[model samples]
Target: MSVSGVREAAAIWARAKARRDRDPEPATVEATAPGIRRRLDLPGAKLLLAERGGRPVGFALVAPRARTLELFYLAVDPDAWGSGVGSRLLQDVEQHAREVGREVLELWVINDNERAIGVYERAGWVGTDEVERDPASGRLERRFLRHIG
Candidate 1:
């Protein structure tokens, strides 16, 4: 992804997060650039962007772990929710994971995000009862995993 692409991704991320919380801080290019650069430089990192009508509508960033693909970030433009953008992005992630020899797909979702939780569950992801704090936002997060081969 290009720097501009990361900026777009950051905007989507911020919009999605803010929809779940009041007055959430926005993610700027400066805030997301370093991580984008770092991930692009990583050997096992996969970044996928979903576009419609030639405009980006969603993105997913996954990194390879020992036996799993960690979905570090996934976001769809708020206006595109419920339009299958999230599902297509996730399916792309799973395909990438399989191509890379990962056996499982894992991600953390903020506990109070019922919409996201429902989407994940409907996609066959199972909650693991593992809770953790998201350092950046101090939100409680639940772990979800799916065996993807």
Candidate 2:
């Protein structure tokens, strides 16, 4: 992802969170873009964007960690929700993991975010017993994992 793409992805992330009513203040790209860029700078990290009509609709960021692929972020524009954009982005993430020789893909989702959790579950990701509190949002998050080869 380029500099501009990171900004766009950040906007989508913020919008998705806001649409779910996750934050009262809602996040801004100015605050989220840096984190996205920092993760993208990591070794073996990949950012996959789903575009429609030459415009970005969703994105997924994954990085290799140990023997698994860690999904750092996945977001779809509110306008594109229920349009299959998120599912396509997830499929791309799984394919990318397979190409990188990583059989396991893992991610953390806020437990209250049922929409996102449902998406992951439909994609065959299983929620594990591991859970943690997000320091930034003070929300509970559960780890989800899937195996693909």
lDDT values, one for every candidate: 0.82, 0.91
Model 2, residue 56: distance off in Å is 0.6
lDDT of model 1, residue 40: 62
By lDDT, who's the top model here?
2
The superposed Cα distance between candidate 1 and the true structure at residue 28, in angstroms, equals: 3.0
TM-score of 1: 0.89
Off by over 4 Å in 1: 35-41
Q: How many backbone clashes does candidate 1 have?
A: 0
TM-scores of all candidate predictions against the true structure:
0.89, 0.94
Tens digit of per-residue lDDT, candidate 1, span 1-149: 67778777777777776666664565665766576667666668877888899888888888998878998888887788899998888888888888988879999999998988888888889999899998977999999998975
The total of clashing pairs for model 2 equals 0
Q: What is the lDDT of residue 114 in candidate 2?
A: 90
- In candidate 2, which residue pairs get closer than 3 Å at backbone N, Cα or C atoms, i.e. clash? none
CA lDDT, candidate 2, residue 42: 92
At residue 116, give the lDDT of candidate 1.
88
In the range 79-140, model 2's lDDT, one tens digit per residue, is 99999998998999989998889999999999988999999999999999999999987999
